[model samples]
Target: MAISFAQCFLAVDDHDKALAFYRDALGLEVRNDVEFEGMRWVAVGAPSQPDVEIVLEPPGAGPGASPADRRAMAELLAKGLLHGVNFWTDDCDADFERVRARGGEVLQEPVDQPYGVRDCAFRDPSGNMVRFVQPRGR
Candidate 1:
């Protein structure tokens, strides 16, 4: 009953590029980076979720992922079939601008979403959408 979900993993085609997006664009900290058995591994953590990490794994890195699966995932990413990762920030405008300044493509300008959140959206290097939001008037 005390189990905890420590992290969520996303399969990317390029680890270094993903790291650059997460670290430079999203402003996440790279907690760990390493390689094993011809595979590279990296993790990023939010400032508040210091203990929780998001694993950025390359396609076909897992046993269940085959060459075809990797190709399929790459195609899907290119077509923007993946859902974005949403993050809460204290300054959505600041974060959005920072991301754009870093050569990150912002899919949406900062605006008040219908859910009462002021947000902006962008895509990572691998075509994964990521949203940064802040509470209105905060």
Candidate 2:
């Protein structure tokens, strides 16, 4: 049997704003957007990676979390303390320019890392750091 990544999540304060950045700016496609169990369930994925999806959810959305916990989580999110995921792109510089042109907050410009990848970073509207990386020589 082979194991593979299926889904990961990012805490989003507003679903629509997240979509505008992920879909409109980052060029991810919305795979699912529906309401379930009194909550909105939204998922987005890179078109090239159908099996990998990122779920956009509210802070402390787990069933066991209390109101205070949710508020704390929200505060952390607003403070840019929550970790977001990194994405691999075929063209890091092009993607970086696109995101920047669309008004994404630049955290870092593209640079070749010692690890042998060219990468850049931006902060989403909700303050989550989103990174794009490309292997050197392509």
Which candidate comes out best when scored by TM-score? 2
Backbone clash count, each prediction separately? 0, 0
What is the per-residue lDDT of model 2 for residues 23-134, given as tens digits with 9 covering 90 to 100?
9999999999988776776999989999999999988889999999999999999999996879988899999999999999999999999999999999998889999989
lDDT of 2 at 40: 78
TM-score of each: 0.89, 0.95
Candidate 1 TM-score, C-alpha based:
0.89
The 10-residue segment with the lowest total lDDT in model 1: 77-86
State how far residue 72 of model 1 sits from its true place (Å): 1.0
Which stretches of model 1 miss by more than 4 angstroms? none
